[model samples]
Target: MLENPAPPPRTSPATLDPSAAGAGVPCRAHPERTRIGNRPARRRRAARIGVPTDSPELNWLRQSLRACDLLASVHSISPSDRALVAFAIEWAPYGGADTEDLFIKFGAQRNRFLHLLQAAMIPRPSDLGHLRNLKTTLCNDLLRAWNDTPPHNEKQCRRL
Candidate 1:
């Protein structure tokens, strides 16, 4: 007989004993295997291709986004929204990303992308002032450009 017997291996869902699994609750033997740990893994996978953040001038926002350890903001935001945030950060120094760029990158026209970006930022925590300021500035610039451009037959955005 083995001095220390190993735990029985789980063969199938039907054979899983509830009592063995901590009485129908999750087996907390390994904290890393819990929901909290699993959710971050999903986020990491979703954003595995982190934002491409190279630009002429290095800014705090860009540096934060490009950090080796992913930021909490990155974890909290959705993948699509992360794209918008990245686009905003990259273009902030140059006023903003234009409608054609937005459409090309996001597949949405200026007005539509503006609305989408606004919605995306709502759920984000406001404590991150840098992010909030970046978004606000970008949104303002986009709105201004949207208003300045003539409604019909608009080709290029009017820059102030």
Candidate 2:
């Protein structure tokens, strides 16, 4: 009879480096994986998040609006408007929230949400620096997109 081979040395759990296991794959012990009887397991690719396509202005606006670090200048705005502004700021990078999100979050339809968001943007003080500019920029882009989305025809835009 053939002599049995010696087992591989055991490794302490604390010494396991997750990177060695592979990126996005969790580390786990599998000592018997070297046997010819057992087929090698396939490695899976790491999951990835997809970034959206956007214009330079939209990108700038997204980053700029989101970087607001002070709230002192926004006190003059009403409480509901403040919430709307905060929500807009939070979702700036995502090209504002979708209609479904608006309904779920604000309990309002698309048209009503846009109106409220426009109102909310009005009271933001000039002291907010880029944030004030962000209001005009964001509102214009959002409204433009809305207008361009017609029932079933080309958008008759005359921005020139």
Candidate 3:
């Protein structure tokens, strides 16, 4: 009979700092205050993609935006990457609540800005719900519109 493997070493809970466990520190340039516990797990997962610890929040945002930009670059340079265009569209609209104020503080202009958001096809409504109510509403409306639009392209259709 094979011997049982020993259990992994136990970590002390006391050593774990919940405040720092998954929280992001805000960049000095952004006007918003950094709250330690406000980040959702999905955001945390997305943020880990290309963000470095010392990078500013602006830099992090830029990196997130770059995912879409890279997809565009791929599509422009190589048609083969068209397969990933859907993912690119999804990434473009997959921002968190952190940037809402910067975009929506303009009041009347916010509607126009939201329209631009509607153009980026996202993959999931639950992902949209991770944002604020206004953003979620806009995303849901755009999703419905996409579903209603003719020329049914399975590649472009997002599963809510």
Candidate 4:
């Protein structure tokens, strides 16, 4: 015999049925083990070497790809009429991942180049003026950095 018999646990109001309350009918007891009460733990794995998992810059690029009207317009056109159709028809021997993924892998400089390319490609009526200005400024800054790089001579390379 137990020293004291514990009272049964009270069911929450959420588990009670109002119709059965005054009808003298017993409701099924809520289960002792509840899946609803158990929350799965969140886990984040580390990125492998040279792999970018996610970052604000990557997120910004992804968002811009989703929002760009010029990209959407290009995708809606016939494949043969696409802006890069000439390159694909004549030079692309092997298929590969998209420009967005490539930009993510290459980092900011490639991202800026893509922005400049896209801004230049947007239809004249579309409002990409701000983006064009931004990319132009960025490209100018990038060119300034390249201005410091020593020029490579073809004769010097042939000697090596």
Highest TM-score: which candidate?
Answer: 2
Q: Which regions of candidate 1 deviate over 4 angstroms?
A: 1-57, 60-74, 124-160
lDDT of 1: 0.53
Give per-model TM-scores: 0.38, 0.39, 0.23, 0.22
Where does model 4 exceed 4 Å of error? 1-54, 74-119, 126-160
**What ranking emerges by lDDT with the best candidate at the front?**
1, 2, 3, 4
Query: Per-residue lDDT of 22-117 in model 1, one digit per residue for the tens?
Result: 555655675567633564555566467773334334445435345312333455456777777567656655656787898789998766776775
> Per-residue lDDT tens digits of candidate 3, residues 120-160?
43434443332334333334533433344433443332332
The ten-residue window of minimal lDDT in model 4 covers: 37-46
Sliding window of 10 residues with minimal summed lDDT for model 1: 151-160
Candidate 4 TM-score versus the reference:
0.22
- Predict model 3's lDDT versus the native: 0.40
**Alpha carbon lDDT of residue 144, candidate 1?**
45
8-54 per-residue lDDT for model 2 (tens digits): 88996645975554666543576446522222232111113333335
For each candidate, the alpha-carbon lDDT, in order, equals 0.53, 0.53, 0.40, 0.37
List pairs with backbone clashes in candidate 4: none
Please give the range of 10 consecutive residues that has the lowest summed lDDT in model 2: 151-160
Two-way lDDT contest, 2 vs 3, winner: 2
Q: Model 2, 54: alpha-carbon shift in Å?
A: 10
Task: List, residue by residue over 38-108, the lDDT tens digit for candidate 4.
Answer: 21221122243443546654444334333333333545323332333222212222232346644564333
